[model samples]
Target: MEHANTAQLGRGPVTSSDLRRRQNGRLASIGEPLPIGMRGADAGGREGRSEAPLPLILRRVHPLILLSTVLMCLATGARAQQSSTATYSVTFQGNWTTASTPGGVVGGAHFTTLIGAVHNDQVTFWESGGTATAGVERVAELGSTGTFKSEINANSNAISVIEQSVSGGGTGSATFNVTVTSDHPRVTLLSMIGPSPDWFVGVSGRSLLNTQGNWQSPIQVDLFPYDAGTEDGTEFSLSNPATSPQGVITSIRGTGKFSNVRMARLTFTLQSAIPPPTPPPPPPGGGGFGGGGGAPRTSAPSAPRNLTAVGGDGEVVLTWEPPLRDGGADITDYEYRVDR
Candidate 1:
């Protein structure tokens, strides 16, 4: 349904009379050849058919409508043949030091909570060398995820956005799982490098689709530094007011106080119910179509065992063994939640 223009079509069913009028109007505008068996002396001329008129509904279907229907059918078949889920384990590696030298931008010591999304190509959270949107400006200037979340949530192409805190100064990581269709196969991530003024690191418009038009698995990408251009502060710690004229969102050139630093890493793993294999071809003599495989697998792994929690001076520790049955594939990751 990508690029399908259904905005003009109303939700209610179209009456026979209305459909015919719409079809006639569209055919006149397109001026394309009629479909097979749809052509006749009366097709393009003003003259009417002498014999019984052909089915009105057949002529009413607009070319774009027909194309949309074909695309829908193809999409259905694609869903049956491909995986529809993808999970990404992202790590924030903060290498910037806090100590500012005789003359250098204060090192970006910590990173605020990471916020990101898996969306279609049509939606982009932020762009380089372009004016930063208000949402991006807020995140870069204030280290707040709410604005970014709100902005992307309003976009129709965004499939999912997730937020999790990752302490800076060292490597902190979080995992995000999203259901993805073929039409939406791109991912984006952003996090403010805290104690810095309008500086953040992330990936923009990174695609999950491989060359073969399928979701790529275990895809890895490195993060780059960008200036949001909302604040004029040169050092990590903001002391100055907004610049006279806000700069356009731009890459942090390695030559200046803001260095092009590689700050994080991300890995995306796409998962799906594996389809059954095709049967081998028969000998020269013809044989039956051949029996296909069995039903789809939909079982989940058992939960962890021997879960133990211990409280220390100011921290709680947790440990547990892997699940007894890992369903079918290997247990690649684990998820934990703490309720207030």
Candidate 2:
């Protein structure tokens, strides 16, 4: 014991075997963790002497100490896993019913561009009963999502945003995928109600994590129409003035509200369970230009068919069917003449 204490204090040179005994005694006396890589013979302080095996030395450690060390490692690993980013597959389906309001206002249900973001609980794009932000006004009044996306991107906790054109009278859909972490587990979405002035539908601050802090799969949420409160026009028209004091954002109600109508549906799926989209297979004979036999040539495309038009507020929408014969080439552009 005297020699062990003296050797540990470095008062005398000792063999690997002697150092190993002293090292154990020192740890027992001080209750301190061993210095990383510090060992008897393996430490190489002395010459020609073998050191004690690490496994043998560990066996001598207190059971409680070993248990605590293992627990610490596991806790660290769990935290790392919890903070890792996860991918979410999100889809938005437009389900608005087309019709006119009692006030003689057009309510043809066609969605504008879909705009949304994965954000933290603290971030907000628009809230019921709150004043509409400029970003919201842009989408509501003009069906633009550029400003809305910028607003969300400025937020520190925003994870991702999606803005794509999606419109329908009763059924339409758009899909996007985003990566999120535990810190940003909520999603918000918005789309303008076309043919309506300052009206839109969306979901806000929808959480992806469950009560147990686990990611939930296949979250389905219904959407409803809400007035942006930026314009006073009662009908879907471009001719309107900005409300003096933008009214409080509110759910669509009253004779103007499409109460009986469903506007849209949002679905959130977990990527872990479902794979994402993949590129389409190559064309029958290799793809891209300068390849085998150029794309099959077809007869000249027939003229556009079923041409129809509708006049609204200050703009007109035209609808038509594709040409019957594409002239062996895909139709790349359209030319339409508007006669006043």
Error of 2 at 206 (Å): 0.7
lDDT of 2 by residue, 1-340 (tens): 0000111122222223332322334441113334432322212222111112111121232323322321000000000112545677778887654432333335455788888888888877789988898899999888888888889888887878866677445466878786766777787888887777798889888888899878888898888788888898876676788888779888884446465456678888888632223433446744322111224333334655655434333222334555566554454333221111
In terms of lDDT, which candidate is strongest?
A: 2
Give all TM-scores, in the order shown.
0.54, 0.53
Worst 10 residues of 1 by lDDT: 71-80
| Model 2 CA lDDT for position 184 | 78
Which residue segments of model 2 deviate by more than 4 Å? 1-82, 98-108, 167-170, 253-255, 273-340
Please provide, for model 1 over 1-340, each residue's C-alpha lDDT reduced to its tens digit, 9 standing for 90 to 100.
Answer: 0111111222333222232212333332123454422222222222211111122222333334433321110000000133355444444455453222224434446667777777887876788877787888778877788888998898898877867787635355666565556666676777876666788878787887788876677677866668888888766675557755878877774634544545566666665523235534433432221111122223455665665434333322344555676544344333222111
Pairs with steric clashes in candidate 1 = none
**Alpha carbon lDDT of residue 280, candidate 1?**
40
Whole-structure CA lDDT of model 1 = 0.53
Candidate no. 1 TM-score: 0.54
lDDT of each: 0.53, 0.57
